[model samples]
Target: MSKKKNKVRPLPQTVGINVPGVETHAHLDMEDFKEDLPEVMARAKECGIAKIGNVFLGPQAYETNRSLFDAYPEVFFLLGVHPNDADQYTDADTQAMRNAFKSDSRLKALGEIGLDFYWDRVPADVQEKVFRTQLELADELDVPVVIHSRDAHEKTLEVLEDYGWSGKPLLWHCFGSDVATAKRILDNGWYLSIPGPVTYKKNEEAQEAVKFIPAERMVFETDCPFLTPEPWRGKRNEPAYVAFTAAKVAELKGMDVNELWAICAKNAYDFFGL
Candidate 1:
């Protein structure tokens, strides 16, 4: 008997219309969109993506993707060193990030920084140290922070608490935790950035989280080139696809999609001070 062949599904050539929304976290600096970045931005505008938070993984990413600010005025930046790259972080990189945020009006937040036990590319201690340093820097600068926690929710929360993060502008980006985790984040007065996973049929936890998280404390994101929502699960995600996630979240919240869109858009503007 012949073995069953496992065929890889192809991504869609294009996705649907952009409903008015804000993508709170995306890595547009990555090489995924180099060939069609202009087209992607055009589609994002057409789809009603009013603003996009382009997160930088490191200083080099900031330099490489800085042109995006000029190319798309709607694009803003979040500078930070991702936990996976924690080993390469340096004082000079930290200084440059501080300088960039100080000088650039468009640099909105210090973000996508936190623990990721899922991939032990960097040791936990080192990641924790880097995370703490950035958190302290954010506290000193009085700027909002965007955090990325994967399989480290408990530790992430503990650290946030230790840092005295209470009622400040903090966002748990690409929130993939349970309702309990959502409640903890809310209790801290921090915001949650919902991503494409909420649209997945099997993501009951995310759906539940959406139901419980108040619309005012909720925002949508694509985390593009990753976590593509339903109907486009196999595709390369983008800022334009944020609308799909928003629609899913709206469904879960038992509200009209347009109303949810307006709410999330306003929430994003308020959170980022855009």
Candidate 2:
């Protein structure tokens, strides 16, 4: 008697309109793409990404954002020193960010900004100073802000509250924090941007947190070239794979993927004013 063989099949490829999406945050100038940005961006365009929100860290990246804007119309710019690079912000750097934010309507938000105690590359005080200053700058410009919070949620919230973010649009990017934290952020009426990692197995925290975010206040992102979802984890992420992230959100929210797509797309469009 011959034994029957079992066949394994690959996951179905994602298909749908690559409607223009606004990546809430990504570091395209991270030196990881120093050699092949053209190919990277080509794939991004092919994937239906209409715009990329690139965050600049210091003086060099600050300038790079301006240059990139002139070079690639599809790429949008945000100016702020990242938490890890907090020490790099000088009076000149802050002035540069302010000037860029003031002069260009294209500069949408002050971002990639917030607390990150995980690496502790800079002193907590320095991070707080830079974060607060940028927040003030964003407030002055009447522009929304994108925040990068990790391990220092309490302090981050405290600072934002102290700064009085009562009527501003705040984006919490790549949100993988706890439900309680999500509730706090939501209570403040800020938007939580979900990324691909929500699809990962055992990512209960992210899944739980996403449940409380209403569709209108939630946005989708790939944070591309990083945080690629399951079945594609460990590989470089791209804009096209954001469908996987949206699919995961749909599953978590108990809604149809199409509905989730529409809701997320609207939220993104409004958030970026695109």
Candidate 3:
């Protein structure tokens, strides 16, 4: 068998049209971008990304690493305790998140929160408790919700419905599920944030779901520092890579990349209330 050498793929800036776009989710605060974050931000800007939502795992991360993106005015914030960290949620953390939201105008949504049966770091009951608590907090704050369900979609949907989140400002992040799942999300009046994996040929379900999802209800996210889109797969993902995801979605929907890019950006801006 021959060894498969790395291919020299085109940079993200070369993948999509130079039209304004938005990266609905990112984690630029992670150690991956610590060394060359400035260069990454520059490339994202050059690739025509207008705004980027930087998600903080919890109140502490928001307080500690939120400032890292202050210099980039186009970056917004999303804060929540992840399901994997269910045991870590406390009343104090809740208070801290409340305080942060009250003080920071950049915090746009309560996000990356929900079920994650894929990882057994936390018990199901504990994860449910934490998820419900954050959902309650989101309602109290009247903020939008960004979900992070993994292999627990049915449970996540049931919980959202139970919380009366239908027709509310909600986003299903990294939605690489099937048409039925996409329909379920849309039926609940929630937005679907298509991630980089949708560009992969193996992710045919998501690709087909994209065709079924209305452009008005669709948005693009790199989920960066993760889910690096092809042409750049196996590389560290950054906000710039969102352009490639948006480009691929446009191609799948038979729309112009520039137009689709702008539409998704607009949808994201409206969803986040930017």
Measured by lDDT, the strongest candidate is 3
Clashes, model 1? 1
List, in order, the clash count of every candidate structure. 1, 0, 0
Off by over 4 Å in 2: 1-18, 69-71
Off by over 4 Å in 3: 1-6
Model 3 / residue 80 / CA error / Å? 0.4
Which 10-residue span in candidate 1 carries the lowest summed lDDT? 9-18
Per-residue accuracy of model 3 over 1-274 as CA lDDT, tens digit each: 9999978788877875677778989999999999999999899899998889999998888888987987999999999999999898999988998888888899899988999999889999999999999999999999999999999999999999998999999999999999999999999999999999998989888899999999999888988889988888998889888888888898899999999988888998898888
The residue-by-residue lDDT of candidate 1 on 1-274, one tens digit each, is: 9999966542222334335668788888888998889888877887677889999888888887798668688888899999999998889988888888889899889988999999889999999999999998888788999999999999999999988887888999999878899999999999999999888888898888789999999988999999998767887998877777876777787888778888888999998989
**TM-score for each candidate, following the candidate numbering:** 0.92, 0.88, 0.97
| Model 2 lowest lDDT segment of ten | 9-18
TM-score: which candidate is best?
A: 3
Colliding pairs, model 3: none
TM-score of 3: 0.97
TM-score-based ranking: 3, 1, 2
**lDDT of model number 2:** 0.78
Task: Output the better candidate (1/2) by lDDT.
Answer: 1
Ranking by lDDT: 3, 1, 2
Candidate scoring better on TM-score of 2 and 3 = 3
